[model samples]
Target: MSPTIFYGQTGKFTFRMLATVLGGQSICILLGALVARAIAATDQGSGSSTAYLVVGVGLGALCIVAAGLMRRPWGVTLGWVVQALTLLSALVVPMMFVVGLFFLALWVTCLVKGAKVDAEMARREAAAGGSEAGADDDGTADRVDG
Candidate 1:
């Protein structure tokens, strides 16, 4: 519930997000290539599908940027946007089910990990302050007794 639990330590979370984005992008690229190949084989004119694949890759790249900017509002927003788009793709193309599932899982992982990372950072900060306060009080206590 605390904000710190969502915005504190972000190193691991950021890394995971980056990995997820990269992985997602790769999947998109691969799928797009396959679609293009299929279209070519059937002479189905897959230009549009190829375009979609390019868009997916672009979105993935944006997500990567977002992961890096996790500390910024833009990063989170862009990441969510990419996630939404990935999910939406499923509605139009059932073939994208596998990619959709993977992206969804990755998104959830980022959310949970992001929160945990922040909580950990906050805890560390608090502990550091507590130690500093304890040390400061130690000298005062001895001085008062003397």
Candidate 2:
């Protein structure tokens, strides 16, 4: 297969991994928060932890939506929402567990994969000596321009 095809596949794989990891995290965090509330029920009003539940649900929704959308606009929006909720609900550690620091690491991997794929495509395109890649006036490859 072509380098573009291979790199593109790698990029796609990374994207999928990011989505799965983030989605899984959101669910786990929501579950953890529920467990915490159950344990705390003996001490105070269960209703008192409403903020935690709400944030967990919201963040979990965001992560789910983000995972569904991947790198699309909705995905970015949902990711921002998740990040905002994470910041606002800093008091809840379990929420982070569900939201996933591991997914953050996966996201970095996704970025690297995307960048590598892009670079490979650009290189291949340039080596093919296409005008789109800043070929010389005669269509020969040029070291610079694009």
Model 1 CA deviation exceeding 4 Å by range: 2-37, 45-50, 91-93, 132-146
Q: Give the candidate number with the greatest lDDT.
A: 2
lDDT against the true structure, per candidate, is 0.58, 0.59
lDDT of 2 at 103: 58
lDDT of 2: 0.59
lDDT of 1 by residue, 1-146 (tens): 53222233345555466456645655574565456445545555444665655665665566566656666645555656666766666554555667766776766676677667756988897987776754554534223554
Q: lDDT at 106 for candidate 2? A: 56
Residue 123 in model 2: lDDT = 83
Worst 10 residues of 2 by lDDT: 1-10
TM-score of predicted model 1?
Answer: 0.59
